[model samples]
Target chain A: MTSSPEIAMPAADPKDPYAMPALMPSSADRAIRSFDYADFDIPTRKQEDFRYTPVERVEEFFQPFASSDDVTATVGMIDGSALPDTVTVRTASKEETGVPAVGEPADRIEAIEWAAAPSELVIDIRADTPTPVLVDVSGHGLDLAALHIVIVARPHVRADVVIEHTGSARLAEGVEVTAMQGSELSVTSVQEWNDDSKHVGGHRLRIGAEATLRHSVVTLGGDVVRLRMDQDFDGPHAKSDMLGIYFVGAGKHYEHRTMVVHNHPECMSRVIYKGALSGEHAHSTWVGNALIEPTAPGTDSYELNRNLVLTKGAIADSEPNLEIENGNIVGAGHASSVGRFDEEQLFYMESRGVPERQARKLVVHGFFKELVDQVGIPQIDDRIMATLDARLDESVAAPIAEKADDGTANNNENYAHNQEEN
Target chain B: MSTLEIKDLRASVETKEGRKQILNGVNLTIESNTTHAIMGPNGSGKSTLAYTLAGHPKYQVDGGEVLLDGQNLLEMTPDERARAGLFLAMQYPVEVPGVSMTNFLRTAVTAVQGKAPSIRTWTKELSEAMERLRMDPKFAQRSVNEGFSGGEKKRAEVLQLELLRPKFAILDETDSGLDVDALRIVSEGVNRAKENTGMGIMMVTHYTRILKYIKPDVVHVFAHGQVVETGGPELADVLEEEGYDKYLPEGTTESALA
Candidate 1:
């Protein structure tokens, strides 16, 4: 547990070094990505951010007029609060554009999003109240699309949000979250894109004085997806808890890079992410970086990443980095591990008369159980489990025991691809 | 009578010191519906026999033939042998995390019996078996042998023996780590298994205490990895009073407890 600071909160500085910088379009990103989207060099493998990802894949979404002509993503409230919706969740108005979340786009593709998207959407939850919001994006066919969302949780309020992406489309999106003082906010972002969908997004959350934020990212289905989660502490005693769970199947790539910047005194952060990969050419990468600034005294933060490999061909590259600029800080640590399924566990099951294949499936199922349960949403958790089971079934899809015409064999093909729409 | 014959059985284990011969040219026969008590001192290969018969990967059988009815037990995998009606109550039962006892037993019963047990009948059978073994009903849903006490592990082993209903059951030190009350309860489960299913049992123990609860038709005194003495039920009483010193070689360091 992170303790609250006993010292008084630092007064707002007249010349706040961390204050908003006045600049050209180069100012805000999560949208800052490409002030010069025109000259934004196609990031090669040399770029640290695009090294693990196939850098060439961004060309499809970079073309102008990428917004879907027919498909319209909608936002719905599922929590049944009956609070009679207050803020404007979404509007097609082109004139409703607002401020971008934070600093300039840290990567090239994010710069592409600024050059693409058609309409601008800003979601503002009235200060000092609780609200639940869900973002549903459904795509059809091959087309370029972009979404930019800015969410503000005013002081003393709690906000819970869920963002889901599905269907076939190339998506470049940016999300910025402003958590005001004494506010509590939790956002669960799920990416269940189709087999051909490609997506990349920059999600940045900035915490205010004495505020807390809980952020979770779950990536299950996608051809190529990368999510960069960036967190900044604006005032003292702000805390952040981050969690993630992902599964990558054959011919798919998923990468999650997260950074927690502790710039205020007495701020704390913790991150835990677990992922699994299966099938040939399955690839997943996780990078966690924690940096404590010089003036940030009494700061404590730690991050951990674990990858479970189910098949020989699958690959997971994990890197956890911790940089404490201020030695006066309390503590900072990070850990990353990649492991294969335990063969001894399988043998124990087989010794009890379970066939080898079934035993293997059981061991993998148990491997992901604890993390899946932590996602906290029963509906989404069940879907993720079903998807994971379908993914594992592909490896053992070979016929068992010569059962002919076996409707069971077809049932084992892995997925129904039930596209959820309401 | 159904005979499970062991002919010229020879086995060795890979110890840190290299392959050490444990069961060398030992032979025994078990007929259905009878209990055979095999008493041996420590390091006499009693536990090795149980593991070898159950197809554990550790012990290597150099030259042997174990025949159950007309099938060869030595040729079958552990799971195959289990499906062919063999049960081993291990000295140290393994812990299988995330596999509940109810699920594990149900799967084994389905594989062995070639069909899933009816739900109501399985529930009744499982509850009755647990009650007879004095195990809490909650234990049925717990991961197999995980976090169980010594006595609880022993009872769980007996519970499997009752439900699996194998043709030949090997009780390997089932009496070892158990209190008197637990010993009686476990023995009662074994007795019920024999009475209801007519299953043959090979009871291996260093003490004669288990024999007091579940009477044996015959008792064999084991020494040097082979049976050196055999007699009727009275032999157990004799060994309990006199020990196995007469059967062991002179200057043998192992205590003659059997």
Candidate 2:
């Protein structure tokens, strides 16, 4: 075990014996939530949630405006089949949607979106699903758009849902999920938007007794994309696995934040997020917050965030915060890392006759293999890998080609020497 | 037959103190099908020579010319050197996470051969090679060298050597951490590769125990970054009995022996 530096504590004041201690609030407790747009102020860098984000790029989504009708969402099966009888998709007013709000909007953008969203798209699953539900969301132009989706998994129902985003738009979106008792539900949200687009999303989940929820987020394209996920346990013996994968290219920013609250006994949660950045001004950030409440016992929770920086001008920030009020709980831990490619690993592969390009690709693929496998959709998995490979090749090949040109010029003298020996 | 020639090779490594020369004007030549043992004490540049031959970025070549069959090996990149029929079985093989042994080996073979091997033949060949080395078949599915035992790592290195079939192979202290049984198993794998491909071998080690199993046709005693003595297999026996003390400079301190 590694030893950590000791933290100095402030001495208690003797003047006021009954004075409450000035303790810093937990991240979850510090977050502000509201359902009304007027209740939220415009976010800035001063806010902890917006500290790492390029707030100016997504400011358009922060204001209350009528959503553009250009945005459209279509629901279909992953295998191109008709919707099964067990599942139904319909639009309803927010007040009459039948599914209670898991949590209020956590930020200005979400609040603005909640107020402007015309209606909620509801997908209700009553039984086991034969195929994954795919929702393709597209924006036609650079206009402001809002989306709200509610996914309900009835008792003992098992289903998979996918939300795919594409096209150019300044968008604000909210996704709410409720896994009823004994149900197993998996949801994946993929953002592959146009390079000129910006997006802000808030995803809220409530897990019921003995229910399981697998939530994944994959962000690949966009000038700026920030997603916030909040998970709360509503009953005992619930399990939540949150996974995220992202790749930020040149002049792009992608940020993901997750908050898991354990309010029931025998609850388990695992958060794993991995990302890679390349090229000038490529940046990515991950912030994971896990809170184990005093009322919760026998809770098993851990969060991990890892980032790989593939170029000189790229940057990655990873932060993991855990707040445990019940020491008697099973366990709670968090770990994070932001680093570049391992030179030794590269050398090992190159020594085995793998070219530098291929070696780097293999290393990156290996780095993300575990988390990508957790996505569990072969088509999406393959798409993510291919996109990663193409981006890596473009970013890695340019510098090597330039270096090779320089090498040829510098080694001209060496070539003459070789000719002499030959 | 192919020949690997090292002429007046001088190299240095950056230490905390500054640039320190490791291989000072070293010279040697080995022909295909020959097994040459390079015996040296710790810090005597045995591993440096191996890594330099394989183009490790840590060791900078100050002045040298390494010719493999009249082609300058020093001018080629590490991967190019491998494709040019050279291999190095590192002492501490790297643990590459998430890259399965099967994937790594297949990619390597494809790069070296300039073509991807047929799936049917490649799978059969890989399993056959693993079986010969007494390696569990599951290792093919596991990440390359990750969570492998010391003995397993060494066997994996030789497994690559047998499969890659390069013109020359450098074993950098391949027997250091192996037991008697593991050493023999690893040695047999090396011998089988030599017999099948007639590939030359440059085995670097500090001890002579491995010589008993994989007999060296020639032995060179290295000290102070240079080859001080060269002889036949009998030289290994002499070093085994006397140790590297006689090879050190006069009055060299014990700490400097390493």
TM-score, chain B, each candidate: 0.96, 0.97
lDDT of 1 by residue, A356-397 (tens): 677666666666766677655564678778877887787567
Residue lDDT tens for model 2, A1-422? 44455955554565653463444454556677899877777889998788998888888887788988868999989888999999999999999998788889988888998998899999999999958999989978877889999999998999999999999877888999999998999999999998998888899999999999999999988889999999998899999999999999989999999999999999999999988888878888889888888778888898888777777677787777777777767778776776667778888888989998899899998988878899887768888888778877877876742221222111111101010100
Among all windows of 10 consecutive residues in model 2 chain A, the one with the lowest summed lDDT is A413-422
Q: For model 1, what is the alpha-carbon lDDT of residue B83?
A: 81
For each of the candidates, give the backbone clash count: 7, 1
- The prediction achieving the highest DockQ against the true structure is 2
Q: Tens digits of per-residue lDDT for model 1 on B1-258?
A: 577888888899988989999998778999999999999887788888888887877789999799999899999888788888888887778776666788888887787788899999999999988988878999988887889999999898888888888899999989888888988888888999999899999999888888989899989988788888889999988887777777667876444353
Per-residue alpha-carbon lDDT of candidate 2 for residues B74-121, written as tens digits (9 for 90 to 100): 999999999999999989999999899999999999999999999999
* Cα-based lDDT at residue A48, candidate 2: 77
Q: Listing every candidate in turn, what is its Cα RMSD in Å to the true structure after a full C-alpha superposition?
A: 10.3, 9.1
| TM-score, every prediction | 0.75, 0.93
